[model samples]
Target: MQKLTINLALITPLIFVVMYIIPLGLRDLWSPDEIRYAEIAREMVSSGNWTVPTFNGLRYFEKPVMGHWMNAVSQLLFGENNFSVRAASVFSSAGSALCLWLLVERFITRQMAWISTSIFISLFMVAAIGTYSVLDSMFSLWLTAAFSAFFFAFTADNSAGRYKNYGLAGLFCGLAFLTKGFLALLLPVIVVFPFLLWQKQFTSILRWGWWVIAIALLVCLPWGVAIHLAEPDFWFYFFWVEHIQRFAATNAQHSEPFWYYFAYLPLAILPWLFVAPTAIRHLGKHLNLPLIRYALLWAVIPILFFSLARGKIVTYILPSMVPLAILLAVGLSSAYQKQTRGFKWGSVVNAIVMALIASAFLILYYLGYLPLEQGEHYRPWLAFTAFSFWALFACLAIRTTTLEAKICCYSMMPVGLFLFFWASIPNLSINSKMPAAFIEELKPYVTEKTILLADHPSTMSALNWYLQRNDVYLLNSKGELEYGLSYPDAADRFITQQQLAEFIKTKQNNSTLLIFMRGSALPETQLPGISKRFQRGRFSAYYFAKDTSHD
Candidate 1:
């Protein structure tokens, strides 16, 4: 146990720092999510209106204020860069892992705590989203905290401990509520109430649930009332459009087939694929254990809940990964104790799978199917090299006698795989996904008085962020901006590609008109009076000089 403790203590921090933290600032902020979150946070800081979140100078209430608040605070501390943008998410994941560690140590075993925390830190989705600028990681942290606190509360021997833990649970619930929305509060109720009923302690909720609600309400009340007072229609849109509509409406955003997460979850949690088979087998025997039951409830119930929701995204199941790490760690620990061949066989399977995938990519690249542009000459080689190393490490895991060495080697394999994959992406793909270079090229043209326009909101967030100007008009004016643009005050900011010519004619004489059309090229005839155009990779920027020659 001492060796295991020291080993995990070293391994987990190494994984968090190298695998998660270092890589955060290494990549450009990907548009739509990363840039959107970054911009919202940037705007929050710039506007000094932490109560409300506005994207591109318009009211955006798709989510509550806390997510932006996190990023906003990070930007203030870390100074408005990629690290600042994604710092909140990394910290959230760390906090969540710490919470899982405490819960497992208290209920399960100290060894299990180390194992679980390691697994949770390096879990695929957790590492991926936790290092990106997104609300899910932060929201997942609060959710994990609430679940852990609730568990602690329920198991407490005395009323004081119980209520105290319950209050902490409620505090997290309120924070979660602010981070996302009503789902935070609702998800806990569904997950916990059922667990309590199973224990025939459902009556306890009636007695102690008030503390949860009162504390949560107290935490949320200030912001809740603040937003309502400021926006007046803040709850109306957030609740009806975001919450209810997203959950049930036919035209919900990102609606997928019911089995979407079920289909992708196995792939998302790929590193632990080796242990999954054994975990399933071990689950029945451990089902009687209270911690196991709680973990199961915590992990599975949310997946089921999110799956049922019409508007589902893979990140919604992040909270599920916490308990899942606990479950996976315990399962592997049991297999080690029993001296089973499960670990060896699982490693063998992983080795074969990784080798096969690496071989397939090499073969494809050899056949000239995977072409690389001039600058990315080494991309394919780097990626395949990473895959080869992973395959080699999987084989090494199989050879190791101790489970600690095996799990460490196995879990850390994805670090090389993912970092290499991220690093080796073709420059063309990079330029398209991350348009910072293109935006920077157009810097001289963009001024305080320049009339900036983007074809879509997907491209607008980066433009608004990189340029540090949000008053830019939208040509498509759709998606998240759809809600913001619907307001009458946003009318002047809305313009379509078809109407660009007429709109440009009105302002072209007085203000320099710069339009960024992303993904596709628009016809010259449509762009009307353009004096200069800058084309970079997949993006095109049209510049109309002040007082254009064309009528």
Candidate 2:
């Protein structure tokens, strides 16, 4: 059994990598988030200045430098492709799973550790974030590691080891801060402080030595100080505008109601959602366990904390998954031991939930509500998921009398989910807008000397990354680039409509200007000699003719 557990431990991560990591470069980098971060890292590499992160050659201080740094390093090694861009996030997420396993193993049996790690990786949000190019996974990794380290510190037998553990925790927290920002530091404190208080470890909380702070400051402050020295305005923008104003105002465009997470958390843990109630109930019975209280606090406090903030994004509550995974493992482990009737019922209910979700998509597809391109292609996968769920339910209902058999049956669901994502998501093309064919068509019209113009460049961030140029001009719009374009060197990059008209009027000899604008935003009075080169979806591309005598 021990050997089997060890084999499972080794095999699970390999499966995760094949499912999550291997497909990093398979899809085109999507817009606004994936492409934006990729372009920033590309700029960091090109500029040779890692301290100040930039998007499209303008200083972008919206996020800290560590994510860019990691991405930059990945790009350096793998070259700037989808895989390189997302490699950091993938590895970070894997690291997070490993940390969870180690942390759980410290408190529970190896079997439970395996269960926790499996649950963590199998989470829909966790797996999705692992594959995407984003900072949240990396931030979650460091935050989880920090919390794990702190847990060790609090439970340490020797004073010397405790201090060392605390320092390691601080270092991970600092790295988390570098990855995202203050929230990295804030999340750990919110989780750990209350947990310590609940455990009546007041002395331990108070004795969280000064060296921990010093170590964290040492890791995080150098970058802050360096960026401030390089760009004096960075601190104000990062701390005030990006953090404070973003939270305080709904104008940041990510505003959701206070109950947003309440609605989304269950979805984030799909297939596993039905298992959560059993976990919470089991946790309630074991409140005296330090780890149980810690896990509960860790999971619940972040939700409450982010709920208070007006700007709510689903990813903001990602760290909660770690504790929730622990709780699930605990509950499931207990259920496994007893072969409880509740576990059987939970499996049946979970299958029903999965079937209902899949059936809804199938119904939508059949009803013509979902797009044919996505729905028709994805329908079979949805059917497969629903079928697998019911199959597992039948197996559990009829044949699975033992705990191991039930677990094996339960594992089939995530395997089906993995296959569905692997086979179906790329075909849907939901994330990608600038198709390769479109890019290839546009490539022939562009040259080094040609200027690319977009009315709203933010809408086409993928173009910036794919074109591999920073000289793309924005016409009569700043959008998200406003922060970066506000820098003195970038001021000339923003052009007014009048200036655009002037440029069209006085075309330079042998110099071409290509403009990409929304089809709706196209000028009512078209320029006389400008020819519409290509029309794809919502975007229209045009080239200005040198001689305007003939319409």
Candidate 3:
């Protein structure tokens, strides 16, 4: 057991280095969440205000400051670069891998832990959250740490200091809540409840439950109370509106069908998705192994809960990966036990499934389902093929009922390493519009005092962050007409088209630049002397002349 623990310990660091450290600087920071979080950290660092996070001088209170604080700490230590931004996740994911190793090692075997950890390292969703600079990675990290702490507390001997362990678990849960929000709290309830019920230890479970809640609140209370005192509106919106409404009822247009997450589950839980049924079959029998049963509850509850929710994103179901990895490990070990009869067929099934998947995508591409030139076409196919080949190779390499099965399963390490760097990471870093392709053209036109005006107030929060400048303006014409009219400094601040014309007439005494949306017609008489620069995509910037700047 000790030797197995030592072996699995070696795998986590190796996987971390291959997935994170090697490709540290290959890509530029992109938009939507990446730059938004980066900039929030940047702002937090600059303003010395950790309570309320602002973006481009707007009241941006969408998430807590834990992720930004993480980036800030990394930036302080490592210096602000792509790697620095992602460093928090590096430690988080590595720690999560360790948790997986220990959990499996304690209840099952070291072999299952090692194989499961290897498979987890390659899981597309896991790689996506852990390697990239995002909220999910940090969230995943805290969640795993908390869950691991909780598991150890429950199973530790009386001599092992159970209270302290549970307390530490609560602390981790608090950190997890701060990292994202209520999802961290919601996760443990759904994951741990089933196991307690199954064990028929409901009384003992309730006895220890209050301490956990107290510890969680103790860790989380300072931030919660402080935020509520500072801004009740923020507390309400963040906790209730954003957290609760988002899942309960679809707010922010984030609504999806109930089956949306279920449909995406195969991709999120890939490779392991097929083995989940087997794990389910053995769940009742595994009650003797607390850790394995804990894993079953951990994996199953989250999928069931989130799948039934109105809100769905690929990331919403990520917490399930932890238990899923364990179940897959158990499944692999079971398969190894059954390997003696005429070469196990699961490898062949994996290969055929992958080949079929690849062929399906290829057929779709040819049938106009996928655009040949744009969208991620060939890479996903490559990724699937790589996954299939590795699974097949691992299955074939191991002799039935021997240690070779354990050794060969470690092949998932390389397979995961491949899909992340070659497939998932690149797809997110490069293919998404989050990374600006027009920065080269747009940079030259922007000067130190350049003011970017957008028809939509929140048009490109990421772009504003990428430029590292907050001198952007928004024309409040959508629904803030009366609210906008109240601002006394109309000439220099954001205004409506009529206000824009009036401001230009009064203030445009020199050459001024204006970048506005495509099809937004400028007044024929206003800004007439502005020299027209060529339009780029959806934006056109003009050099305005003083006299013709107004109607």
Candidate 4:
């Protein structure tokens, strides 16, 4: 036990450093949710509205307060930047590693525990999203924490008193709920209990379990009730509509085929790809190894659950990666112990081949040899190259009859470190350039008290966030012109180009600037009160002058 604790202490620092020091290149900055969520959190802090999250100064309650709160706190402490926002994910990822270590120590051998935790931290998806500033990273971390606490509670010597660990488990679940929502509570029961029951340890259920559950509810209900009371629709939209109905029904916009997760499986697992079969085989052989069985259940059940789920985002199966790493680690590490020739050569060759393929592709991508549609797809290309190289490096350790072979087989640490620094961190650096340009262009007009308005508002969320203001006016097509200018909401205050023309005919204010979509169908001959037009990326700004008004 002491040795296991020491292993955890050593592994904890290493994982934390890996998560903390990794580069956050501009990989997916403008990708719908990542930057948007950060920007919303920034706006919430700037606007002083902790009750409801707003995007572009509108009631945007798609997700819960956990992520937004993290963002707000991050911005408060470090200023509103990618590094600050992403720190939440980094801490959560480290917590996940620590949780895995604790879980393995309790259920498996000390060596297996280390191996499992190491592989988990090194997983492509976990490494990719974990190091980034996104909700999934934190969500997965909390999910793991909850599950890990539950596992220890469930499998611990009941005579030793289980309530403490069980309560901790519930607390972690509550934390998860805060991070993402109810998926936090649903995940452990659905995923873990089936495996425990399959083992026919029905009597294995302990007394203090209810307390953990009660704590989870205790932590979750207050915020949920507050939101429900404050915005009754908020609870309905978030809990039932988003969680249950979205999963139960189709068409919440996040839809993928049942096989979608299957396609992502290899990529998600990455350097462990070659050892997947062996891991499955080892899982079957060691059914009595409660940790291995639980890990296997953990790995496989989420895939099945998500594959059947209507919402099939890649991160949906994130919690499963923890178990996958454990299963793979046990498989490869145990195979090394078995001294099998086929296992040794096959794994090494596979790694080398995968790495060579990745290196070639990366070289091509860097040289512009591979033509992609846009910059966003760079994730897949980068992931492939990084995973391949790591797999190759790991293969080098797999020699005929040497402990070094085993070490080589699991060389995900360096690979994860390199990708975290070279790939994931730097990804944000690349994406921040365009937004930086927009911010620079808009800076001259923006003042401490400027009432900035954009037609889509989303076009300016990043801008508003960067400028650290919540006063951006979103002029989308919502009905408000009917009030005859007595009063208007933010949505109605936006005068259409047609409205702008009429207003020019009425008042002749030529200096008014109208920001419109580049392809919007504004008739040129409606009113000849156009002073100038400027185009920037996907948006166009028209400076309408009253002098040229000649309908």
Candidate whose TM-score is highest: 1
Clashes of each: 0, 0, 4, 21
lDDT of 4 at 464: 63
Task: Give, for candidate 2, the lowest lDDT window spanning 10 residues.
Answer: 1-10
Off by over 4 Å in 3: 1-12, 250-252, 274-284, 340-344, 352-432, 455-459, 475-511, 514-551
| Global lDDT of each candidate | 0.85, 0.75, 0.63, 0.64
Off by over 4 Å in 4: 1-20, 25-28, 203-209, 342-395, 399-434, 448-458, 475-551
Tens digits of per-residue lDDT for model 4 on 1-551?
A: 11122344365356546445556543335534556777877777877878777766556656788888887887798776667767777777777887888777766667666676667776778877776667888788887887777677776676455777778888888988888787787778777678768778655544565787799889888887887786677766677766776787856447788899999988888656666676566555766777777777777877888788787688888888887777777776666667655465657766766667667766766776654435445654665656665565555546324543343345443454354325432323433323545455656654564444455544455556667665554444432112212233444445665575565455443334434332243465776555666555444555454344454
Model 2: CA > 4 A from native: 1-7, 250-252, 356-369, 373-399, 402-412, 421-436, 507-510, 545-551
Tell me the alpha-carbon RMSD of every candidate. 2.1, 3.3, 5.3, 6.0
TM per prediction:
0.96, 0.91, 0.80, 0.80
Residues 396-461, candidate 3, lDDT per residue (tens digit)?
Answer: 433224443443444352454444435433333343333455444566666665556655433344
| Residue pairs that clash (backbone atoms under 3 angstroms), model 1 | none
Over the stretch 353-406, how does candidate 1's per-residue lDDT look in tens digits?
887877877777778777567666677777887777787878877777776776
Colliding pairs, model 2 = none
Ranking by lDDT: 1, 2, 4, 3
lDDT for each residue of candidate 2 in 1-551, tens digit (9 for 90 to 100): 21222245665766586658766787666656887898889988998998988777777888999988989999999997878989998888888888888888888778778778877887878887888888999899999899899999998999898988999998998998898888877887788888877877767867784766788999988888999899998888888987887778767558878899999988898657766676666665667788878888898999998888888888988888888888887887676565566776777787666667667766766677664463456655555574565456534533556544444445445655554544444333442353444565688777887777877755446557878888788887788779888878888888887777776665545567787765446563855466556766655678765553543
Checking candidate 3 for backbone clashes, the offending pairs are: 31-434, 122-416, 527-548, 527-549
